[model samples]
Structures are given as structure tokens and as C-alpha cells.
Target: MTSIAPPRLPEPAPAGAAPPTSAPVLRMRGVTRVHGGGATQVVALRGLDLVVYPGELVAVMGPSGSGKSTLLTLAGGLDVATSGEVFVDGTALGRLSTKALAALRRRSLGYVFQDLNLVPALTAAENVALPRELDGVATRKAYREAVAALTEVGVAELADRFPDQMSGGQQQRVAIARALVGPRRLVLADEPTGALDSATSGEVMRVLRARCDAGAAGLLVTHEARHAGWADRVVFLRDGMVVDSTGEPSTPESLLDGDGGSTAGGAER
Candidate 1:
């Protein structure tokens, strides 16, 4: 009788891991976002400072309209800050040309949205390989990478399923697989588990934490207190500023306080 081979194991991390943090993966200094100029102008971010280090999982929390989305977009280079500067790996965004910036973003950044922004018509593998396809990678190679990414996120079985065929948790996992499929250095997720049920949200957060532990930096923008427990740090934003931050570490209990911070905005700058 032929013996069946055992399943291959995931790659083990190096014995001596890199410092959990180093030069920040992304930095924003005195960042400010404005809605309209002059009379109609409204400041979204009021000269805020943010830094995310390698292997760090940081969560951003704020009331709606507090500029949480704007801050995430600015950090991901999806939206430009109206004033101050943002740096991804020390490359100040203001210094790069549009084409250069686009290239920089593709090389180092990955983003997941509340919508997941996946194509309904495409299969999960195809959807995950979109970035690789855009970069002109060979189809076979791109799909191969996509499959590996899916496996890492425990969604390889769903590779052929369309978005509509997957559950909300499965869809979010696929989105995460897509984000990290490439050689991503920074991962930005905007309320990734917002739509998931309690049990599923816990699973998704574990996946995210595992990714960050494996060397990728993650910035999660979320309102759910339970989800915050997945991060190494939780930063509270109010009226467009990081009013307070805590390195509470990840645990079910840390997430118990659904109301994360003081309502009175203080020391926002």
C-alpha cells in the first residue's frame, strides 16, 4: 500500500526574529485634511502625528466624521493630505512625482476597504491576482501567488468562488489574501470586520494578527471594540487627532470596553 504524504507545513519564522519594530513603516506628521478651501473649508485632520512600525498591528478608532477614513486614505496614499506630510518608509510623499508615487504605492502598500472592493464577476483567485495582473506578471505566476496567499489566510478552497458565493467572513478573508498576496510592506484595512458576526470577526482578527506577526505592518481603522484586541496598540482619534493611545496587547478582555476612550477631546495634537 502506498503511504500518503503529510501536508506541508507553513514556513517557520526565523529563530531570532527582527525587532518587533524599527523605523516606522509609515509616518504622518502634522497631517491636516480639509474639505473645502476658504469660506467652505473644514479641517478634517488637525496637524496629527501617526507612526506605524514594522510587525505592528495598530487600530484607529473614532466617531464617524472624525476623519478616521481620511487618515487611513492619507496614510495609504489614496488621498493626499492638505498640509504637512506623510512618509512611507521615509519617502516623503510630497517628494515623489505622480507616477513615482503610484509605483511606490504598488511596491509597498496594500489596502482593504469596508466594501472589500472586489469584482463580482471574477473568481476569488482572479480577484486576488488583480494587482499582479496590473503589474504585467505572467497569468500563471500571478495565480500561483494568489493561491499561496489564499492558503496562508486559510481560504484556498474558496479560490474559485465568486464574491457573491462567499459569506461575509470569507469575503473579508479573500480581501486580506489579496492585500498581502504581493510583496506588501504595509497593510491598511478600513473596518475589515465591520460586517462580520462576533465569532467570524474573532477569526478574521486572528488572521490579521498572524500576518503582522509574520513581519507585515497593519493599520486597521475600525469602530468595533472587540476587533481592537487584535492589535498591539490601539490609538483613539477624536475630531481628527490621536487623542490617546495604548499598548494593551491582544486579548478578548482588552476589547471589552466598546466605548474606547473619553468623549471629551483632550490633548488631540
Candidate 2:
């Protein structure tokens, strides 16, 4: 009898396909977002200063309406701030035109919205390949990359399944695979596990941590304490500013202080 061969595995891209040296991948200084103008205006961000190094996973937390969303939008170039500067890989966001900003986000940033943002009509592999397709890559090449990404996230078997057929965790993994499929450097996730239960949320956070270990910089906006435990650091936002970075160096506990402890790196501390 003839022996059967083992199934093939997806391999990582060659070194030439990698991004540049790990520098300060994202930076923001004196960033401010003001809603309305003159007397009717309300300040959202007040001179916020932030930096996310490569291969780091920073967790941002705050109460509702604390300008966390504003900070995230401004950082990701989705929404512009009225004052200060936002930089991705040393290029100033304020200096770029709207079109330039769009291009920058497309090539460098990967975003995971709470909704997962999968195309309802497409299979998981197709959904993951959407970005590459938008960038004019051939369908076959994009699909291959998408499969590799899904395999990395341990969801390759779902490649042919539609979104409606998967669980919330599986859908979120698909979203992550999509975010990581292209030459993306910064992964910005907004409540990525909000829809899952505690157990599934833990699994999702584990995948994100593994991604950071594999050289992707991630910024997560989450309110869940369990999820916050996986971050390298936590930047608590309040009234549009970084109220604290309480974690000790890179230790897990230093990054997370729940139930509202004292601020770590504020004016007083």
C-alpha cells in the first residue's frame, strides 16, 4: 500500500517582505480634538502625548465619554485633531493631505472595529483578502496571503465558511486575520472582545498578545479587566488625556490597576 503524504502548511513570508526597522511606530504629542467652535466648542483632547514602540501592545482604558475614542480616531488618522501632531513611523499626520493620509492608513494601519467589519456576502478567506484586493493585488495572491494569515491566527479551516456560520470568537479572529494580511504595522482594535464571553475573550486576547510577540504593534481600546491583563502597558484616558501609565516597566500588573487606582505618570506623579 502507498503511504499518504502530509498536508502542506502555510509558510511565513520571506525577510524581504518584512517592514522596516522597529522604531517608534506611532507617536502623538500635544494632540487635541475640539468639537464645535468658539463658545459652542468643547475640548476632547488636551495636549495628549503618546508613543507606541514596535512589537508593543498598549491597552487604553477609561470610562464612557472620556475621549478614549477621540484619541484612538486621531491616532489612526480616521479623524483629525484640531491642534498638535500625530505621527506614524516618523511621518507627521498634520503634514499629509487627506488623500495622503488615506494611503498611509491603508498601507500601514490595520483596524478591528467592534462590528468585525466582515463582508456579509463573502467567505472568510475572501473577507480577509479584501484589503489586498483593494490595493490592486491579484485575486490569487491575495487569497494565498489571506490563508496564511488565517492560519497564523489558527482559523484557516474556516476559510470557506461565511460569517453567519461562525461564532463570535471565530468572526473576531477573521477580523484579525484581515488586519494582519497586508503589510500592516499598527493594529488598532476597538473593543475587539466586547461581544464574547469571558472565556472566549481570554482566547482573543491571547491571539493579540501572540501577534505583538510576532512584531506587530497593537493598540487596544477595551473596558474588560480580563483583556487588559495581557497588555504591555495601559494608558488610562480621562477627559481627553493620558491619566496614567501605572505599569512597572513591562510587567503585567504594572500595566493594569483596576477599580481606579492612583495615576502613574500625571502632573502630580
The parts of candidate 1 lying over 4 Å away from their true place are: 1-18, 248-269
Residues 1-269, model 2: lDDT tens digits: 99889988889333212232455577777788999999998888888777676667888899988887788888899988899988898899888998888888877898888878789999999999988888788999999999998997889999999999999889988998898787788888889887778777777777777777777778899887667767777888888887787452232332453311222336423
Clashing pairs in 2: 247-254, 247-255, 248-254
- What value of lDDT does candidate 1 attain over all alpha carbons? 0.80
- Root-mean-square deviation of candidate 1: 10.8
Please report, as a residue range, the 10-residue window in candidate 1 with the lowest summed lDDT: 257-266
TM-score of 2: 0.82
